[model samples]
Target: MRVAIIHDELMRRGGAEQVVLTMLKAFPDADIYTIAYNSEGTYPEYKEYKEKINTSSFQIFSKSIKLMQKFYFPWGIIAMKAVKVTDYDIVIISNTHCAKYVNIDSKALVFIYTYTPFRLAWNPSSYSQYNNAKGVFKWIFDKVISCLKYIDFKAALRGDYFLAMTEETAQRIKDAYKVDDIKIIQPDVKTRNFYVSKQPGDYYLVVSRLEHYKKVDLAIEAFNELGLKLIVVGNGTKAAELKAMAKNNIEFKSGLSSKELADLYANCKAFVFPQHEDYGITPLEANASGRPVIAYGKGGVLETMIPYDVHESKCTAVFFNDQTAESLINAVKTAEHLIFDPAFIRKHAELFDENVFIKQFKSFVEEKYEEHSSSVIKSH
Candidate 1:
């Protein structure tokens, strides 16, 4: 079958972008459709996909447009809708943002792997950019945000089927769109890249964008108070602010190769994840490395990490309920007292491996395609 994948702009490599790459592997022949593409800005490996990538006229202004994402998002939706995907038999939208707004023919089978309803639309509190606006800027923000919410809702109604990334996201979609019958398709983690280390390192590790909603600040604050060695491995808008707040115990590094990341995951005393994600893949990556996680016990982490308790000898992670430094510190202190079985944690991670994802996602899409084809035949 002719297949095409639509994704939000590809300017950076993150969990959402990783999911798009996995989808490409699932349907290797599928062409990728997006509003813009920046080869050097994202993963260097994406350079190979340059031939299969189809972008809108918006790509011509990629540089300036990306810097103004807040203003360009609606334009992106417009550009995506203008691009036709009717030629493809199957259109799979890997959307954390606006790709679901793509226009497809009625005959084409379109399935969306929804991470969440747009955060700026449905859950603006989680978006730092919007939450930080002030005075006149806040007024403009509200006006644009309100308009986007309306447009986003109308666009969401166009999907033939929705495949949620987790139960948490599924619930959000149901609430936001009032749509039922959503399939849950979790993203895959490459477990083989990581392995258990015989001797764990002294420092704790956090590998996430230094964004406000990611709550990297909480991790930094907790570690600072505890005077524990912490290594933060990612760069983002809040990098300078986070660095200024950090003590000598906190170390920051960026542009680590895959091998370097894998080694850090393998040897870290514990992995820290303070954000509420739709389906947090980092925790599973940590588990794959046979290292326990110290995460906020909310959102997708609940589904991924096996929370530590007295009864579970082979627990994988411990969670702090509140999004605060005090809470995370307490959780960390508690986690230090628990016994984590490296083999058990790695085994648990194996359940969500790349192979499992490919098999399940391929099967789900094929089944939907067949069913939709059968319905078309009956209608005729």
Candidate 2:
């Protein structure tokens, strides 16, 4: 059976890319497709798959038309649709953002890893850029978001099935697009490397992409008030600006491997997650490492972490009601009083172990194909 797995891009070995790789392992013979492949050397897991993956026709958009691509996402649709994939029996789209836009032939099952549809119109960067753009350019970006929101549904209708990574996203998909039928396929977090015996309980840590929505500034501001040391691990467009705002107790760090992140996860006094992340893996990492996570009680964290009475008996991690700095500070202060059970934290995180994700996802793909087979037989 010829299978084609589609991904938004392999820009980094982040949670989304990990899902695609796990899919490749499940269907070793399947051909993988992507719009870009920037994570070429960063992740060694795909060394053998280097030859099996299909590159997109929109290679230029990977670089030249990049920033503009967010607002003008149809350019990506036009770019990806050019690929000839009519021959495959199955086409699975693993997406956080853009893989859903790819066009494929009928008959193949289009299973999507449905992360919440980003609010394109209110997206901070595009909104900021649109507000500042001169004359016609300003109108163009604003129009594109509204236009793309419409196109998104037209494109979304392509999905034969939907796979939500978390319950929060499942609800969001239902609310955002009115699509309620969904199968939950959580991402994998390799826990073999993270063992918890001792922790570096001095500094609170945050590992994230440092995007505007991540609300890293909120983390920094809260920690600043608490006078607690904060070590942030990530680099993004907002990194420099965030670094500039860093106080004496706060430090901005980046470019750490998963192992290093796990170490921080295991050692940190507490993990600070201020973002309304789509589906953050770091919080899972913190849980797997037996570290308590301080997260906003919204978005992905709502599904991943638990609200606890105290630390020693925390269900998973704790969440603050609001995403603001003050709310985070209050949560952190309360967290300090709890007596955490390292074993319980690790055990809770095992629920989201990468192996489980792979097993469930593989079953979903294979099951959908089985359903597809029956429909074909009945039609004939």
For each of the candidates, the C-alpha root-mean-square deviation to the true structure, in angstroms, is 1.7, 2.7
Give the per-residue lDDT of model 1 (tens digit) for 129-161: 777889998898888879878888887887888
Clashes of 1: 0
Candidate number of the best TM-score: 1
TM-scores of the candidates in the order shown: 0.96, 0.90
Model 1 lDDT, full chain set:
0.86
Q: What range of 10 consecutive residues in model 1 has the weakest lDDT sum?
A: 64-73
- The 0-to-1 C-alpha lDDT of every candidate, in the order given, reads 0.86, 0.74
Cα lDDT tens digits for candidate 2, 1-380: 88888787765556676667777777788887877665442366766787877767666545432353553466666776666666888888876556666668786777777666656632536333555677888677768767766666666788878878778778767765668799987777777757784746688899876666678889988877889889998776678888888789997776777677677777888888887777888888888888888888877777777768643585666778876777888889888888778788889889888788778878888887898899889999
- Among all windows of ten consecutive residues in candidate 2, which has the lowest summed lDDT? 63-72
Residue ranges of candidate 1 with Cα displaced over 4 Å: 61-70
